[model samples]
Structures are given as C-alpha cells and as structure tokens.
Target: MWADKSYTEVTFKGCRPTEPASNFDKSVDIQLYTAGFGDKVGPLKHFTKCFELSTSTATWTGLPKGLYYFKIVKIGGESHELKKIDVDQVRVDTTLAD
Candidate 1:
C-alpha cells in the first residue's frame, strides 16, 4: 500500500411523518480505528440521501415515524488491510403510524 488512510461518516435525521424520507433511510455512522495511521488522522465523510460530503455531519428530516438503526462499514483496498465494524440494530420510535 502506498499509505494508510481512514474515513468516518454520520447522519442526523428528523421526521414528522408528513412525508417519506429517503435520505436517512440508509444512513450510517461508524468509528474507525487502524494501525496504518500511526500518527496521521483521516477525514470523516457524512452522507445525506446518498450525497457524499466532507463535512462534520449531514442533517436530514421529513421521514415517517418508525424504528431505525445505524449502519457502519470499514473501507480498505486490496493492498491495505480491511476491517469490518461490528454493530447492532437500534430502535427509533416515531409518532407516525403505519
């Protein structure tokens, strides 16, 4: 590998059940850790409705009320080491009724 690199992302969602929200439908957050970046730090990317960005976070809203969970993925190349983050689903309660 040429050099070690890492990334992180997070999404914030707000809903009122008035409209369906697809942006935060597949939103995710992850905590990254690797030995490759001994001293150097990487950037954290936030996504809102599949929009790739380099900001601290992505704010979303206008979604139905329901339970939701966070999804995380560890990215790596062929030459670089790969690690998958282990996380569990969570319950997100909303006022919307199905």
Candidate 2:
C-alpha cells in the first residue's frame, strides 16, 4: 500500500503457513529507508528503524513526510520488496479566506 498524507499510519497484512498441530508463531520485520538508498545495500544496513509484528497485520505510525522505500523481512531472514512512496504532500490554501 502507498503511504499518503491523508493517512497517519501504514498497515501491512500477510499470511504464513504453520506446521499442523503446532503453535502458530512467527514474525515479520519491516524496514523503511530514504528512496533509492534501500537498493544500494542491505535493507537492514540502511533502514531508519525496524518494526516487528507477530501477527499477519502490522501498523506503523508517526511517519514523516518524504519519499521512502519499504521492505518486509520474514522470520527466516528473507526480504521482500514492499513499495516506494512519496508521502502525499499537503497543499496549503494560501488564498485569503472568503
């Protein structure tokens, strides 16, 4: 999903297969970085911060306005490209109030 100014938070959802009759336990690691920086090196190396979610759904908040690269890491250390978004810039109404 794209991060835009209208939303204050970002949510990611995914599913994983678990061993039958065993406890369903797993986590996902989310990383964010400046646009283009993420691809030059490892996601973890250039990440701004890391977020872990035990369930399939994850929500990140308090993100600043800018272009960011997103990635998701599975429990086994596999990384998946998520998306790049330029947080929608807020347009201010400069005209004098009518």
Candidate 3:
C-alpha cells in the first residue's frame, strides 16, 4: 500500500504460505528500510527496532511507522528465508499451522 503521510496505522495481520519454506518463523529477523527513491517519506532511514509474535495468535503489539520497504531475514542459519516481502506487515501464522 502507498501512502503520503508520515503517520499511519499499519496492521501487521500476518502471513499464511502454502509452502513451508516460505513461512515466517519466530527466529526471523526482519529488516525494515524506507524506500529511499520514493520521495523520501521521513527522516528515518533505517529500522528502529524488531518485533516478535506467536505463530498461533495473530497480533501485533508495536510496529514502526514511516517504513517503506522491509525484508525478512532468515534466522537459525537457514539457507533461505521462510518468507519475505516488501511491506510493513508481519506474519502471524505459518503454512504448517494453518
């Protein structure tokens, strides 16, 4: 979703991938970066912090605003990411769960 405001209520609903290799796990390290090419939304250029959620209960406590593009970094020394996307949302459920 595209926005033109510095403040926005981004709801990280979660993700449900059919393939198990594309699911967001608990050890995933998401890296959020503002789209530096799209008019520059805010002064914030890097990720402020990271968040952790349960795969069973779909809920987000606190997600940062002013973020444009974000990537999920695979943890647990995995070769590939379980799931990755270019948005300000987080995954609440995995393929195996749902």
Model 2 clash count equals 0
**Candidate 3 residue lDDT tens string, 32-86:** 3456654422222222223233221222223344335534434422433444433
Clash pairs detected, candidate 1: none
Please give the ranking of all candidate structures by TM-score, highest first, separated by commas: 2, 3, 1
* Candidate with best TM-score: 2
Candidate 3: clashing residue pairs, number = 2
Task: Tell me how many clashing residue pairs each candidate has.
Answer: 0, 0, 2
Candidate 3 Cα outliers beyond 4 Å, as residue runs:
7-26, 36-67, 77-98
Q: Report lDDT (CA) for all predictions.
A: 0.28, 0.34, 0.34
Off by over 4 Å in 1: 1-55, 74-81, 84-98
Query: Judged by lDDT against the true structure, how good is candidate 3?
Result: 0.34
Q: TM-score for candidate 1, please give it.
A: 0.24
Model 2: worst 10 consecutive residues (lDDT sum): 85-94
Ten residues in sequence with the least summed lDDT for candidate 1:
77-86
- Tell me the tens digit of each residue's lDDT in model 1 across 39-86: 222333333323232222422234222222233332221111233211
Error of 3 at 2 (Å): 3.7
TM-scores for candidates 1 onward, in order: 0.24, 0.36, 0.31
